[model samples]
Target: MLWKVFMHHSSMIFLGLCSGSGVFYSLACLKTGSCYFIEWELISINSCCVSMTLILDWMSLMFLGFVSFISSMVLYYSGEYMSGDENMNRFMYLVLGFVMSMWFLIISPNLISILLGWDGLGLVSYALVIYYQNEKSSAAGMLTALSNRIGDVAILIGISMMFIYGGWNFLFYVGDMKDSINKEILTGLVVLAAMTKSAQIPFSAWLPAAMAAPTPVSALVHSSTLVTAGVYLLIRFSPALESTISQSILLLLSGLTMFMAGLGANFEYDLKKIIALSTLSQLGVMVSILALGFSDLAFFHLLSHALFKALLFMCAGTIIHSVKEFQDIRAMGSLIYQMPLVGIFMNLANLALCGAPFLAGFYSKDMILEVAFMSSINFISFMLYFLATGLTVCYTLRLIYYSLSGDFNLGSLFNVGGEAKIMVNPMFGLGLGAIFGGAFLSWIIFPQPYMICMSMGFKTLALSVSILGGLTGYLLNMGSVNYSLNSLYFHKMTVFSGSMWFMPFLSTFGVSKLFLQSGMKYQGIGDMGWSEYYGGQGIYYMISSWSSKLQILQDSSLKVYMLSFLLWLMVLFFLVL
Candidate 1:
C-alpha cells in the first residue's frame, strides 16, 4: 500500500524533475543569452553530417519551465480526479509522455529532431484524447489526428526542400535565406504547418471538437502545450518569415480566426468546448501578432495565455466533474453558492483572459493591440483585432452569467463539490499564475518597455473595447431576465452564432458530404467509365479480339500463313516505296 501510494504520485515526481531542469536551464540561458547550442552529430547523410541540435535559449528554457509547472499542478490535481480509474497508471504515463514530447519539441531547433517531438506530441495527444474510448472520443481523436497530419506532411516537405539550404538545420539560416521563389515556397509551407498546428481559420475545426478528451487532458494539452506549439514555432521562425507573402496570408487568416472563435464562444454552452474555443481564439491572437512582426510580443502573449488558459481549463474541468459531468451552461446555475472555489477561480481565469489590468493577459494582450494600432496594418485586420478583443470579454461574461452568477438551474441530482485536495490543490498554483504570469513574462521578455507614439484615443482603444464589451455582455445576458425576450425572435442570429457560423458543419459534413458526392461522380464517369475502358481494359480487349483473328489466319494452314506473310511484305514494301 505504501509503494502503491508512491506510484500514485509518480506523475508529480516527474514534474519535480522537470521543474528542476527548467530552473537550472533558465538561469543558464540568462547567463549565456541565446547562443547556447547542444549539438550531437548523428550519422552523416550524403557527406553532410546530420546532427541533433538543442537550443537552450531563454525562450526554450522559460517555455519548458512554464510547461513543467503547469503539468506538475495538473498532475497533482489528477490524483483525485482520476483516482477511481483502473487505467489510472496509463493516464499518468500518457500525460508524462506528452510532457516529455513537449520538452523535446521545445529544446530542439533542428526540424528533423523537432519532428521526433512533434510527432510524439501528436501521437500521445491522440492517445490521451481517445483515452475514454467512446464514440465521441474516437471521432474527435480522428479529427485532431488528421487535421495535424497536414502539418506533419508539410514539415516533411519542408525538410526535403531544406536540402536546398545544404543542411537540415533551419535555425542557422532562418533570417539569412534570400527571398526567392524557393524561399517563398519554403516560407509558405512552414507557415501552413504552423497555422494547422495553431488552429487558425480553416484548420480550427479540430480544437473545439477535441474537447471530447478528458478534462485533465483539456487542461494540459488543448489549453496549453499542444495547441500553442504552432504559435511557438512561428515565433521561433518569425525572423525569416516577416514581410513575406506567407506572413501576409497568416495576418489575414489569423484575424479571421480570432473573430470567428470569439463569436463562436459567445454562443457556445458546453463548458469545456467554450474554453476550447477560447484557446483557439487566443491562438489566433498570438499568430496575428506574430505575423505582424512582433514575435517577441507574440511569445510573451503565448507564455501568458498558456498560464491563464490552462487554469481556465482546470476550472472548467472541476466544474464539469463536480456537477455530475454536466458541462452545458443551460444545465448549471448559481454554482458559486455551492462551489465557491470553482466560481472564484473561474471568474479569475476569465478575468485574466479578458485582459484585466495587472493580470497576465493584460500585459501581453494589451501590448499586442497597442502595437497593432501603431503598425501600418490594413483596415480589415485592425477591425478584426479590436472586435475580437471585445468579443473575448463578451463571451467570458456570458459564461459567468450562465454558470456562476445566475439562479440555480442544475438538476436535483447535481452536487456542486470540489472538496478533494487532489482536485483543488492544482487550481491554487494555477490561480496565482493566472493572476501574475502575464506581468512576469512581460518584464522578462521586454526588459525595455515599448514606446508607442500614438494618439490617446488609439492607445485606450483596447481597454475601451474590453470595458464596453463587458457591459454589453452583462446587458445582453441579463436582458432575457428583465424583459423575458424570446431567443426565437433572433433565431437566425442565435443559430448562426451558436453554430459558430456553421464552421463546424462547413468543416465536417459540409466538406465530407461534398467530397463523397464528388468522388462518386468521378468514380462513375472516369474511373469506372471512359478512362478505364479507353486507357487499359478497352485497349486490351480490342487488341485481343484482333489477335484472335490474326492467330487463326497465321496458324490455320501453310497457305494462309504464306498469304499473311505476303500481305505483310506487300504492305511493308508499299510503305517503303
Candidate 2:
C-alpha cells in the first residue's frame, strides 16, 4: 500500500521517503558510529526451505548512505527538471525502482539477494535510458543493457562456481574454500565482470554511447549507481581475491585502463564523452587502489567521485540545454559572461576533477596515488600511474579551457542565456557540494584517528608535475600548432599506413590470409573465411542471418506460444529452485 501510494504520487512520496530515510540513516550513523547491527533469527517458511541469515556491517551502512544521498538528490533535481514531460510518470517509476534495487543490493546479506538487486538495477537503468525513446536513446540503452548483461552472466557463472566449489554459504564459504577453488579461474572471471560493469578498458565503449540518454539518467545511473556496482562487488569479495597473482592482474589492468582512458579523454571533442572517459579512468583508479589493498582509499574515492562527477555532468547538462546543442566543446566559447554562475560551478567541478589541492578529488586521489607508490617501486607501474595522473590533468583542463575561456561566439545561433530555475538550482546545490563537501566530510566522516591526515609531500610533488603538464598543454593552445605529441604521432601513423588502408591489409591480408588461404578447400569457404577472417564481413552476415531466422521463428504462432510458456516455466522453476 505504501508503494502504491508512492506510485500514485511519485514525486512527493519518493522525495519524502528518501529525504526522511537519509536523515534517519545519517542520525543513526552519528549515534552509533556504525552503519550495521545484525540480528539473526531462524524462521520456518516451509517443510523444506533454505535457511537464511542476515548480516550487516559497516560496508552495508556505507552503501546505504550512498544510495540514500544520491537518490534523494536525483529525485529532488528530477522533480523540477522533468516536470511536464510526457514520460515523467514512467521516469518516476524507474527512479523508485532504481532506488529500491540499490537499497536491496546494499543491505542483502547473501549473494542471491545481491544478485537479484544487481539484475533489477541493471534492468531499471536500461528502461530509464530509453525513456526518451529516440533512435540514439534506444541505441544507447540497448548498448548499455547488452554490456551489463555480459557482466551479469559472468557474475552468475562466478557465483555458481562458488556454490559448486567454494560452498553455498557466502561468508563461511570464503574460509572453507580457500584451498579448494582455483584462484586464477575465480579471479579471472570476477575481474572480467568487474571491468565490464565498471566501464573499464575495451568494454568501456558503452558508457559514452549512453550519453544519449537524459541528463538525469546519466547523472544517476552512469555516475552514481551502475558504474559503482562493480566497485562494490570487488570490495565485497576482497578476501576471495587476495591472492598475489590476482592482485597483480587487477593492478596492471586497472592501471593500464586508467592511463588509456584518460589519454582518450584528452583528445575527445564531445563534452559528455570527455566526462564518460573520465568516469572510466576514475573507476580504474579506484580498482587499482583496491588492488593495492587500500579498501579505504577505494571507498573514499568512490564517495568523492560520485559527488564531483554527478555535479560535473549536471553542470554540463545545463550548458548543453541552454545552448541547445550537443557538446562539441569547439562550438562552445566564453559563456561566462552570460552564464556566470554555471561557468563558476563548472570550473569548480573541473578543478576537483583535476585533483586540485584541498578539493574532494585531490584528497581521495592523492591517497590512491600514495598507496600505489608505496605498494611497489616498479618503474613500469610508477610510470603508468604518473601518465594517468598527467592525462587526468590534461583532459580536465581541456574541458575547462575549451568550454569557458574562449571568445564569446554564439556561432550561427543567438544567445540562449542560462538554464531554467529547475536546472540552475540543482547545479547550484551540486556545485556547492563539489567545492565544500570534501572538507566537511574530511572532518565529519573520517575516523578520529584519520582526522588529522594530510597529503603526502611526494604526492603533492606528483600533483605539481601534473599541473605543469596541464599548464603546458594550455599554453600550447595559444599557438597555431593544433596538435600535441599524441595527435602528431597518430597523424604520422595514419599517414604511414595510408590512412586506415593498411589496417585491413595488416589485419586481413597479412594475418588472416595466412590462416584462410593455407588450409581451406571448400567452395565459397575461402570467401566466407576471408570475410570472417579478413574483411570482418562475416560477423555482419552471421548477425543478419541469425536475426532473420529469429524473426521467422517468432512469427510461428505455435512455436512462439510454446517458447513463451517454456520461458515462463523456466522462470518459475528458478524462482522456486
- Note the Cα lDDT for every prediction shown: 0.84, 0.70
Q: Which number leads on lDDT?
A: 1
Model 1 regions lying over 4 Å from their true place: 1-5, 481-485, 520-577
Lowest summed-lDDT stretch of 10 residues in model 1? 1-10
Q: Each model's TM-score? A: 0.89, 0.77
Tell me the TM-score of model 1: 0.89
- Give the best candidate by TM-score: 1
Residue range 1-577, candidate 2, lDDT tens digits: 3443244345544555664565466656666766443434344333322333344554566556556666666665666566657666677778878877877766665655567678997898888878878987897787788778888888777766665543334555544445434656666677778777887655666777778767777887755688888887777666667764767878887887788777667667788888888888899899988887777678778877888888787778778876766588877777787788878878888888878888888877776777677665478778888888887887787777777886554578656674667566666656766777667655555656332333566647667768886986576554512345455657754353222223224432454467555656542666556655656676777788999988977786897888889999999999999
Q: Cα RMSD (Å) per model?
A: 4.2, 13.5
Estimate the lDDT of model 1: 0.84
